[model samples]
Target: MLDSDYTQRFLFDDTDVRGEWVGLERSYAEVLAKHSYPEPVAQLLGELLAAAALLVGTLKFDGLMVLQARSTGAVPLLMVECSSDREVRGIARYDESLLAPGATLSELMPDGVLAMTIDPTNGQRYQGIVALDGVTLADSLSNYFASSEQLPTRFWLAADGRRACGMLLQQLPADRIRDSEEREASWQHLRTLADTLSAEELLGLDTQTVLHRLYHEEQVRLFEPRSIVFRCSCSRERSANAVISLGQQDAEQLLAEQGGAITIDCQFCNHSYRFDAADIAQLFAGAGTEGPSGTRH
Candidate 1:
């Protein structure tokens, strides 16, 4: 119950393969609540959110991991950001009238490109880009790993309007099974079992049950599960700084155009930050005069 939104990792004991499972319920609902998204858009966002979480689980960093896709089809853009703390938020842009029932991923995102960005707080940022040419997002991610890092990775992602779930299985460096043919056999065997996993089972079953169902005869080592929550990193102070970036003349003109105050809204959270005249003055104040009295709604 308490672990409704979490990620669990496992190692196929004595093998070079590891896997992760991510399920989102409340966090998905919270992202859905921020704006009114069509069914297809909502479903895509959910999958992206789950995918971001799944990828971030294997990474060791002290910053943000972002998955962004830009397409030439109905869905022009979709993005999901997950922090090292396991917080995730996502948004999708789409033309509802252009969407059709049972549209394939390629149809929804023709000629699209997916970018994975890892922005470390203390180090340089790294980004990997892949073409979204597969039947699903999972396929595109697998392609990314294949082309970019040459790591053998596979992903299974599913998202309804209500919840999102995903699984990740990757082949690590040869440790237990060194023979190339043996490794290939092991990977195929594991993937064969994983292929039997349905989206419904992934969404409904617990980690232990899911693992048992897939790897009934394998030696698996389960790790501690981590919690995932929905969080937007928007702040009134950042909003105020945005106003300051507009410069004195433009900021004043815009304030005047907006009836003596300017309102900045965060697209991710839809939170409004209102800055009045004195607040503006405080923002453009030279040196460390004082902070603005901006209010958030």
Candidate 2:
């Protein structure tokens, strides 16, 4: 499966902190293939992709989580969504000329705020918004976790558009402790070692290989790997709802102006859904039970 992506989460038997590692290469290629983003846009997308994966690793939820930003400056919007199953999709809406090659998130989205939303398959949607004061994606996300979860966590995320990577280390409250300072000291020491991990090592090494190289002295237990892939939740029926929101008159007008047919394309995945004369007729003419239009039957 080309979707079989990179990420590793582990627990240390000696410490009360959990850790995770994630990387991306061809997985990013899948998303980049849809658009010709500028260098900064591509790099930002990679960071978002890595951030989404890090959130997936940290949160306890069985649904999709989306990280997005709406800016009033160079980049209008950037979205990165990942499901519980590790299916990821991302896009960046930006003006190429407004940003430079090595622009940071604050530079690109000057007055932007970061937001995180959770959409369960069968539950209420949850969302959170935070100010963007941090200089980098990892910094902003760390601020989000500190404010939202009130947890002491660390995140190291990196990417080059072609590949993205991340590592998360978090403190878990312990019941009994002989030396609280020792635990903190151990975590600090471990993070120092993890800090040395380079983007190349993260993107190129295997889970155990990287862990051994970083924390070979500690007792680390690696979990079974979970796969990741590019999956878009958009469908023709959903697209039809979009067209319907345009109202029957406007839809018909667009249909009439475009030869009695309308094509709805999903911006997330570039998948197009076509609605013809019969589809339009059946949609508005028949009983409401007849789904939106062009639903895969």
Candidate 3:
């Protein structure tokens, strides 16, 4: 059986190629449990979650990577975020009435733009956008890497609502001493081998078994696997800071309209935070000196 909720990185011993495999199980279940999403939405979110985890594994940074799609079709918005620490969270906004059985990617998000953002812990943010022109999320992401990063990348992603899994292969820059034609041929050979991978195999096989099945003849090095978990970064302090950023006048007005207390609910984790009049007073009083003092539920 596949080892779920983990990402493993691998490399080719003789080629400038690297790959990553991500399998999501417990983390996927945790995200789905927070909301009663429809079948189509849940499946799409699962795929995105897998993609985000795979992408994060490729980068060597201490930060967060977000994959988001915005559209006007049955599903208006889908987003998934994975931090360097391996915490994952995702949410989808859609119209259930329009979602039918076996809805395709275009049917769920027609005329959409897919954006990937990388926010580092101590550096400027970078974002890449591509049109959602493919039938699958994998296709669009492949296009993004080709255009934005100028890298030859391929992805195979699958999700069954219960388990989400994906594989990514990237051809790194060739060495100056290496023959250009030889490197090109090697890249094509590996890509062709990866192309033979089926969604069923990706979702069903463990990392070791899958790699051996695909590249038994080649020298492939597998790294230690990293665990992925469901975690929400939302807290009452952040919510309080958001409220304080609204300024004292507007904050008080919102509190008055809400019957002397304002509640903030995290869309990703369904965590609720409540701040009463006294809490608001303390927030404004210690605005610059301290953090929010609201209660979390």
- TM-scores, each model vs. reference: 0.96, 0.87, 0.94
Model 1: per-residue lDDT, tens digit, 1-297? 548899999999879999999999999999999989988889889999999999889988899999999999999999999999998988888988899998989999999999999999999989989899888988888888989966799998888978799999999999999999999999999988888889899788888898898888999999999999999998876777787789988999999999988988888888888877887777787533244644565
Give the count of colliding residue pairs in each prediction. 0, 0, 0
What TM-score would candidate 1 get against the native? 0.96
| Deviation of model 1 at 177, angstroms | 1.2
Q: Per-residue lDDT tens digits of candidate 3, residues 187-244?
A: 8888888889998998888899989988999899999999999998988778888988
What's the C-alpha lDDT at position 263 in model 3? 91
lDDT of 2 by residue, 1-297 (tens): 323376778998888888887777766888998888887788778888988887788788889999998788788898999999888999989986798766778888998899999998888999989887688878888888789875678877777777887888888886433488987798788888988988788666667888999999999999866666787788766776777777778888999999978987778778878887677766676433244445332
Off by over 4 Å in 3: 1-3, 287-297
Q: Candidate 3, 49: how far from true, in Å?
A: 0.8
The deviation in Å at residue 25 for candidate 2 is 2.2
lDDT, candidates in the order shown:
0.89, 0.80, 0.89
TM-score for candidate 2: 0.87
RMSD of each: 1.6, 3.2, 2.1
The deviation in Å at residue 66 for candidate 3 is 1.1
Off by over 4 Å in 1: 286-296
lDDT of 1: 0.89
